[model samples]
Target: MIDAPRSRYQQVADLIREAIQRGDYAPGSALPSQPTLAGKYGINQTSIGKAIALLRREGLVRVIKGKGAYVREIPPISRYAVTRYAEAVRESGTARGAFDAEMAQRGHESRTELVQWGETVAPQVASDALDLTAGAKVAIRKRHMHADDVPVQIATSYVPWELAKGTAIAEQDTGSGGTYSRLAEAGHTVERFTETIRSRMPTPEEADFLRLDEDQPVYDVLHTAWTAEGRAVEICVHVMPTTQWVLHYEWPAS
Candidate 1:
């Protein structure tokens, strides 16, 4: 096996990250000061800062102005399938889903909150995801998913508002119903969903909204659900910080 060289800062950050992962520093708890970390590691405070920066990029810790760094939400390992939640619910004839079941079995409870719903997709990012022509109308749905009160995923979805207007699908809140169920009730059966996955650092705004740590890296997942006619009805993008999340998918045999 080839030995990989690691930097002092990386080594220090890994130590701190491991501590955080082991719940030594619980979420919302403060970490030691830069000088303390430097003293403990026998490195310069600058090196400590670099290590903390690494943790921030990995979504492990958030720095406050006077309060120092704090541990934030960490993701649960999720065993997932491409199958829609609605299908799982229907298959089991239960309101809860197989995905939720899997997570609960692992000692994590899944919770979702619908943040916003609107009849327009004004943002360029949302418009593109919905595959709308320039200035085309689209519905906007924003939601957050959590595991044990720690936010794990932040999602926003777009649907052609012109097509969904006056339909019950566009009016429901996250707690009242799921978008998939609403779409089915409104007579658009989702036949398939195509997903694209990527990763990047969260924007400052995203960091604030998702309460992400500076050391945390987020996974960006984009999905589009289509009907049998091949008309795309829903497009969703989810940003999840790595510490608090693992996106598992089982690929069907080719």
Candidate 2:
């Protein structure tokens, strides 16, 4: 039997994508005009257009309105692992240090901008996660995490207002080791954490913040903390862009 021949558009797309991988078309640089590409490939402009579309869908290139197609410029995401919150790491005295340590390894700096805060009636999800119901209020603190000034993740933490009303967790800056530290000081002393993760296409608002294509999805993480007494202390909802993230984890097989 004979192998089927590849389509012209696919062939062109593969060539261009390979060129990108080989750095022939450096990231952040414009590609040759569609007409020029069509001429070089000896194919019609429509074929060239389809080839370019293939590259765009695969995230190898982005076409800004009137800006033409440019190779996408970005570094791979740092692998995020749950172990970063180990006691030894938290001893560094800044909860954010866990994030900084990971990003620093890749030469990327991290920052968090306070986005929303204040007491509010708990959302159904928050209410269920934190053991609150019947319209109980929550102390909601939210922030946008960025890597080198590019927004990467949005996190909103929910704690029962009764426990957080006069605590440092309610403040803009939860001094030193951050919220977890404050929770400990207040006797919550979280003994472990549980994270539930899911993936879905970005909401219109999420797409705008993450600068993602319509096809891109985001990771939704529900991270919760609990004490030895089995009382839930904090529940944080995190929205992370899927393209720019990698997760690492380890466990003893036995």
Candidate 3:
């Protein structure tokens, strides 16, 4: 049996992908206009649009409504599960959190914008993770994290109101080492962390905040910080774009 011919859009997509791989279209550079691509490929604008859409879904390019499509600039960031949470690094006083330390080590400028910080009723997830009552109050800290000035992740942390009340964790800055450090200072040292991760398409708000195209998906990570006595001290929700991150993990083979 012979293989059938590929569709026009598929062919166009392949050509464009090849050009991108060959560096003809540099990362963060705009691709040719639809009309130009159409004329150059002897294809209609509809096919060109479909081709670009296909590329967008493949994580090769991003489409801007008024500006047109551009090659995706952000490289995949490797998230080291274990070392990122090292107590020594947090106590070093040079970085605020794992995100800041990792970005600085990678030679990228890191920034955190405090979106919301205050006491609020615990959400179901937070309540369950922190073993709090359904209507229990909790201190909330929401931050938008950036690397190289590009939006990368959103982290929102929740702690039992009594634990965080009148503490630096309730403040916008959280001093050094971030929430974990403050928790340690408050006699709730985190001995270990549990993270549950899932992936889904970005919501309208998340897409807008992260500047993500419709085709991009995001990782929702529920992180629970626990103490040596097995009490949950903090619950944090981390949302990151899938195209911009690669989670890494390692453990002893004992």
Candidate 4:
């Protein structure tokens, strides 16, 4: 039996993918118009649209309304789960958080923008994670993080009001070691952390804020810092574009 012939859109997608790999279209650069691509490939505009759509779904290209499709510039950054939270890593006297230190190690510029900070009613997830009653007020610290100037992650942390009020943890800038250090100073002393991760399509607001395509998915990470005495001190929700991160983990065999 003979193999079936690929569709025109598939052929076009292959060509575009090859061109992108060959650097014919540089990353972050827009592709030619649909008409131009159709003329070049001798196909209809509808086929061109389908080809671009295929590329978008494959995480190779992103289409913007009225702006055309552009190559994705940012590469995937590795998230080292085991070492990122090591005491020495954050307390190395650099005054940088785990994300910043990781970025610097890989030669990428990183920045964290404090979007909002203050006390607020705890969301259900936070309430449960931190063992707070529903509708209880908590201190919130929200931040938008960038890698090489590209928005990549959004993290919102919730702390019990009793622990955060009048503390640096509620402030815009936490001193060296960030919130964990501040928590330690305040007698919380984080002994370990737990994270639960899941992936889902981006919401409209997330897409707009992260400049993501409608079809791109995001990793939702729920992180909790716990104390030696079994108290949950902080709960943070981390959202990151699926295309821009690679999660890494390691543990002892024994």
Candidate 5:
């Protein structure tokens, strides 16, 4: 680590990271509170706050705003040279396809459980990403996706409700199916999706929901699906347990 300025917050973050990398804190362990770190380093609370924020952005720790920080665990890299699982599965002869077939042969049912569904206007971030009015009404769907009933990911999908409103696709009886398939049936072909990957420790609530331990960190994935004509449509964000899933994506030769 470089010798940094006396910027209190960054110093604290560096100390914590050094301790972690040196195995003093160890993975999956919780660090002492801001006050403790502040006192130990003879710094004030505000500096500790800054240090924690830096760590959060660096993906070394995750704080639930009101909750404390915990050490983050690194997810397993795929044996396949891909970036996302969904894309890998779709591409022919992709490593992801072979892996999925093998997993299916062993009888792993990729299932989805409906968690939430409703209509609401877009928040600023979703609106900007989907290019909708800041408060324009949209349809929101949330699902807990699983592999053979084991919780694999929690995804929240947002769509312009006016387009699919009153249709069977947004009805309560769509059952446990993927939103992409349902949207296609509704005449909205999903052409492309962009995803952003980030790392963080799971919140206590998320840990319980996903049946993960304190040691297993979560991967936060934010994605947007667009139509072939270049119109942004559905926006989805998923929090997945890194220990349970591997995401792969393959790019065709240029």
Candidate 6:
């Protein structure tokens, strides 16, 4: 059976994408206006709009409010490796030390800003992950992670109030080694971590926060840190733009 012909906007979008890739439209350079493109292609202005919208959805372009759409400058790629969780790295007293190392390896800089800090009743999933009863209070440590000022990931950690009550984990800053290192000093050593991830379109607020295209997807990761005694010490949820990160895990062959 023959496949259906591509839609008008799809064809134009593909053409524009090829032009961008071929250096016809340089990165950070604005594309022609919708009316201009429509006239150039002898198509309806709506079709031009639709084509630009498609490009935005693919992250090939970004629309600047009050201005216009421009070809996007793709950022350099970086890896989120399983080895970032190594004890040696965490023990060095920078909870983010692992990420910083990875970024440096790629000639990028890593930074974090504390967004929300204090205590809250553990949300259901966090409650269960930490093995606490529903409604149990937990210290909440929220951060905005960035690569060269480009917002990349939002992380929220839920630690049982019992373990964090008098510790720095409940503060705006986790201090030297980051939360895990501080937890270790407080008798809640993290011996292992497990992460589960899923991808979905971001919520309205999340898209705005991450500065993502309305239709772009984000990866949601649930990370659980466990103690040697088999107790869950921290339950962290990471919201990362799918286009901004790559998760890599290395394991021995079975």
Candidate 3, which ten residues in sequence have the lowest lDDT sum? Answer: 87-96
Off-target runs (Cα >4 Å) in candidate 6 are: 1-8, 22-29, 39-44, 64-66, 87-92
Tens-place lDDT per residue, model 1, 142-214, is 7776777776677777878876677654665422345666677777888988888888888886777667645
Candidate that scores best on lDDT:
3
Query: Order of candidates by TM-score, top first?
Result: 4, 3, 2, 6, 1, 5
Model 4 C-alpha lDDT per residue in residues 24-142, reported as the tens digit of each score: 99988999999999999999999999999998877678888898999977767898877877733544532237778788878889898888888899989889999989899898988
Quote the lDDT for 155 in model 6: 82
Top candidate (TM-score)? 4
Counting clashing residue pairs in each candidate, in order, gives 19, 0, 0, 0, 7, 4
Summing lDDT over every window of 10 consecutive residues in candidate 5, give the lowest-scoring window.
75-84
TM-score of each: 0.76, 0.85, 0.87, 0.89, 0.53, 0.82
Clashes of 6: 4
**Model 5 per-residue lDDT tens digits across residues 67-150:** 688775442223232333454345423212333443454466655566767777776657787888768977776777656555
Give one digit per residue, the lDDT tens place, for model 3 in 38-101.
9999999999999999988877888888999999776778888788878436545522467887
Clash pairs (backbone) in predicted model 3: none
- TM-score of candidate 5 relative to the true fold: 0.53
Indicate the worst ten consecutive residues by lDDT in candidate 4.
87-96
TM-score of 1: 0.76
- Comparing 1 and 2 by lDDT, which wins? 2
Candidate 3's C-alpha runs over 4 A off are 1-8, 87-95, 213-215
User: Which is superior by TM-score, 3 or 6?
Assistant: 3
| Candidate 6 lDDT, 1-254, residue by residue in tens | 99999998899998998999999999778998888899887889989999998888777788988788988654535555467666436545555566567666677677878778888999897888999998899999777877766677788889999988988888876778777877888888888778998998988878887888667998899999999999999988888877667787776899
